[model samples]
Target: MAGIIGRNVNGNIAYLTALEPALPGFITNDHKFRANDGAYTEVIHTNAGLLGYVSDLGHVDFYPNGGTDMPGCDSAECDHARSYYYLGESLISGGFTGRRCATYVGAMTGNCVLWGNLNMGGLVPKTGSSGIFYLETNAAPPFSRG
Candidate 1:
């Protein structure tokens, strides 16, 4: 399955900085893995098991249309764009481990980088009779109007 998940960006700038191999088994299944432009956005996936979470390095930036060169907007007359960033982190317990990774970047004019942290937790793997079965959790935090 495919879908979009995350928060909406208003009028502000956002930036994300993450560490390498931040998480294990982290992957981007689609191009919408991160918010582009200066509008509310989120990461998208084609699989149904990969779970996702908010990262301490996650962030968003909003800029007036024609103000920034962000990827989410294209019209020169537009007035705003939203930016998003994701980081890799794990929240598994009981010997089971999971990690997260983020992708994407946007640079828009008149846009300032806003700093924020996102902490997400969920089941990235499934248990079966044979043992521990691992699947992409693609988990995301509950959607908000931020």
Candidate 2:
């Protein structure tokens, strides 16, 4: 394509010469010149204080590794396997709110908070039917043994 011709001196500026009429802009002897396209123009400078330009459309990648996988479960063994699972843990120090559920699943778990009420219809099964639901809380139920 097009090229640049110039001279360089220790304390003097460089200039470009013999440029075609199509090339627009001031041709300096101490700086490099380039033609700009429709999109963005890439500019690079050298240690000698010379600058260069290149037209770049952009770049695309087929695969991007941005931690797409779910967290907490380091391996298959850690996974509870049940489609709906909820696990929570909390520590009471000096009367703090304490930690809540660490992991949760299912539509309700994903949509509602752990302390929120669950409006299960009479038809809802308490035991296994399709998926098992597990809830781990800090406090035991009213009738639960210590």
Cα error of candidate 2 at position 78, Å? 1.3
Cα lDDT of model 2 by residue, 1-146, tens digit: 21232122221222111111111233333233332211111111100111111111111000001111113444323222111111111111111121112222232133323343221112221121111112222222211111
Least lDDT summed over 10 consecutive residues: which range in candidate 1?
126-135
Report every candidate's CA lDDT. 0.22, 0.18
For candidate 1, write residues 1-146 as lDDT tens digits: 11122223331323221111112244543423343322222222111121222221122211112113223334422211121221222323212121222222221121223333222222231211011111122223211112
In angstroms, give how far residue 53 of model 2 lies from its true place: 61
Regions of candidate 2 where Cα sits further than 4 Å from its true position: 1-70, 81-88, 91-109, 113-146
Q: What is the overall TM-score of model 1 with all chains considered together?
A: 0.17
lDDT of 1: 0.22
| TM values, all candidates | 0.17, 0.15
Misplaced by over 4 Å in model 1 are 2-104, 107-112, 120-146
